[model samples]
Target: MFEEKRSILEPAGALSLAGAEAYCKYYGLKGANVVAVTSGANMNFDRLRLVTELADVGRRKEAVLATYLPESPGGFNRFCELMGGRSYVKDELLCRFVFPERPGALMKFLDALSPLWNISLFHYRAQGETGANVLVGIQVVDTEMDEFRDRANSLGYVYEVETRNEAFQLLMR
Candidate 1:
């Protein structure tokens, strides 16, 4: 048991599975030869939940973002167009926004963007804390980046890209 070998200590649930898969991919090892040690017998729902939550990040599949959009017509639509049209794949984007704290803000946002971008995940919380934070996920094509930025700038919204944020790297990739 003390033999010298490279060992990876992974979490007890979904993250462990993702880690094992990442390891095999990194080493070009076939599943037939690699043994992934994951024990589910001692796992609890809470821990499992946490594992599931982090599994995507562990695999670099999701991203957390903080975007600010104007509280006006077509703002959300412009954002969606910038991201890419709806209909996304697994490796798309997971974006979050801090919406304006005002009447018709949410409606204006949704009305302008829905049906165009396939929202994979959405969460809205009004903390009465100056801005409404919203999280969204969409697919984006790399070639249209300049157009995206131009569209975003024209929308008259203060937006911040958080895909490279430290918290995102630590929690969501």
Candidate 2:
């Protein structure tokens, strides 16, 4: 019999730790000490960048989300309200949004949200189409998640919360 009463096997790679943790959480495994073996002598800059990007997500220390907003007055304000009040260093939130590609869209988005939360990170990927992928990190309190949900729901644009997404953990954890 195995020496340990319980065992879990993880893939041997750069992201073994993140993957193992993700697997355990996905399977709802608990009450046992799990060991992970990660093998890598060195990592290149690209690999290092990728691993850093994914570390937070894999550890559930960040959330990835997408939202749609209208090009109308007060639309952006409502979205900011959904994220709760101003950031106070304690409420750090990570957010991503799919923005409609058009004149002043990016500026409007930032102008509205920056005043509410201390955005720690932002990434914009233009697809040369009608919409662009925008990743944002903000500071918000967990207790206000309900308000976040309500704001997103009524913001008049489609939105999705990707906090528990496996792809996020794998690609940017």
Candidate 3:
């Protein structure tokens, strides 16, 4: 509610949107319309902090993370103080692949290329038992793009590179 309307909703109201977001995220939904029925008009000003902090995280403008810290005093403080990670990664390739929804389809796809490249992200879209699509984010150095292409071709699934999709760049980067 805050992200869209700039109004706060009680916890119950937020849950509907949260559930919808989770479902869309989990299913890699694209260009789909969703409806979330929110309830409860009870508002508290204190809850604004959580909305301000987390809304951006959900929108990909900010990051909220959980890390395992040593079970010792000051662990939480140390974790909070640390800001670490690579600024950018240029080798990731995003591809959309469609495969028949069958018993061996997923494992077969995995077997073809999983050993050759580090898969940074994998998402599946369900289409009942008819077929499915996957959006894969695999890391391949420039020098190895041809080899990666060959391996991807050998998988025999219909696929295309979507690394340059503007919406993806804006939303998932």
Candidate 4:
């Protein structure tokens, strides 16, 4: 099980291939798995591409809070509804707040969240008045996000959706 997990994390390359070859030579390994071998330079280029293109894959695997959204009931609900039924939402992360520095501000913000939605897994507040930016990170499970943009637009939040492929290319290039 551990070997399988590690294999998933391993990059395609000569070292891994060589190791497999050595293991087969010594231990008489037998399997129908196909193997491809390439030079280090080619591997490096491909690896860079994979790293750049799949960076978002890591983000999708783990949720990081984004500092975007206003402190309003309608805003909160719209955000949640936009994220409704996401496949990756095992928890919510709340980091940084740009709301007014007054009593009941935090309460009002919390109240805005629907009970149907899970409590944030992470939370924090901005340091100064000038930094009125609320950062929220939510887990995303579903890769198919056809309605996400529409929902966010309906709620009046400007959002940028970066697919894993595009994110990787942007990062790699």
Candidate 5:
């Protein structure tokens, strides 16, 4: 009986009330323990809804922002203030770069981050075609936010953050 129930739950097998009962009986589990049960066509009908519900949970996914900024006076401080003002930012990841046209640009950016903030993670430089842009990606734990935009405004960097929900929806579609 246990074997029969296990077989019913198998992806290739048909699911039915009788099959589910056999499975429960074999496992010595009660019907209340079963969150859902389906057989054949019913399974197909339910699958998408289940997937949609699970996808909804992804909305709580951490937010990550990537920024491109130039090395300049007070630029870093303004960035920090923007992030600091937000109560939801969990951590910052810094990536620095100097355009091939300019030397020592990376060092200056790192120095900027040093005075008031701790870099949770850092990466530097792209392999080729050094542009004036430096990309930084930061993970935010909370969702209620807009301070990052203000921070970007202060720092003069174009920034974008993707919340988990947005990412999930994009992926689902």
Candidate 6:
């Protein structure tokens, strides 16, 4: 909107238009007349996410979404069955991440991770209201765990290591 109209819109200002667009896309509506009454009151980019959060989830699906799975190939099949869909690792550290629903969040995460460490497990789903809870499994040796933590912390997203989680031990190890 700012690029085309040269006007900055707060989250509330663009909410109606955003919702309308989401509705159109989710239902695959084409060549239809729609109206949106947009209004704003000095909001920030953080809250601007809520505009789409209220958009019946079509737009939200565009963001990074994640979930965990078992390491065995059979776990993949079981997971798929559980979700009614189809679905690795040594010294793999599990971490849950609050991935923002922004455009570059996924790439940002991969850019930080892929080149340096091996990603053993990854699950993503785009249905979060605020963002996706991305669970990433990485092949980080015990000695490198601290350095890995530092790298993760520097990514500007909230994350925590789940190596000691009992469910992870039973499911992955």
For residues 1-173, what per-residue lDDT tens digits would candidate 5 score against the true structure?
12345322223232355466677889888745553455343345355444334334544533445896669988876887777643333554333333343576555544544333544444343333434545454543334235434444454433344334455336323
Candidate 2 has which clashing residue pairs, if any? 54-172, 54-173, 55-173, 56-173, 58-173, 91-139, 91-140, 93-138
What ranges in model 3 sit over 4 Å off? 1-88
Ranking by lDDT: 3, 6, 2, 1, 4, 5
Taking the tens digit of each residue's C-alpha lDDT, what string does model 6 give over 1-173? 65477665676677787799899999999999999886666766666555445443544545556788877769877876787441245677788888999999989998887787998789875544688888888888889877887888889998978879998778763
| Model 2 agreement with the true structure over 63-160: per-residue lDDT tens digits | 77889998999999899878883443445555667787778876666565556556676777654465777766666678866766555454443445
Alpha-carbon local distance difference test for all models: 0.59, 0.61, 0.79, 0.46, 0.45, 0.76
lDDT of 3 by residue, 1-173 (tens): 75467667677688988899889999999789999988646655556546555666777977876678899998876775576422355689989999888889988888988888888888886554657888888889999999989988988889999999998777564
Runs with alpha carbons beyond 4 Å of true place in candidate 6: 1-88
Which 10 consecutive positions of candidate 6 have the poorest summed lDDT? 52-61
Deviation (Å) of 6 in candidate 1: 63
Output the better candidate (2/5) by TM-score. 2
Model 4, C-alpha of 52: deviation from truth (Å):
38
**Shift in Å, residue 93, candidate 6:** 0.6
The pairs that clash in candidate 3 are: none
lDDT (Cα, 0-100) at 106 in candidate 1: 63
4 or 6, greater by lDDT: 6
Candidate maximizing TM-score: 6
Q: Please give each candidate's TM-score.
A: 0.39, 0.40, 0.49, 0.26, 0.26, 0.50
Model 2: ten consecutive residues of lowest lDDT: 1-10
Cα-based RMSD of the predictions, in order?
18.3, 19.1, 14.4, 18.2, 18.7, 9.4
Q: Model 1, range 1-173, lDDT digits (tens) per residue? A: 00134332235433565676788888888845655555555655565545544645655766657899999999998998898654435545555677778778766655545544555666775544478677665544666456555554554545565656778546542
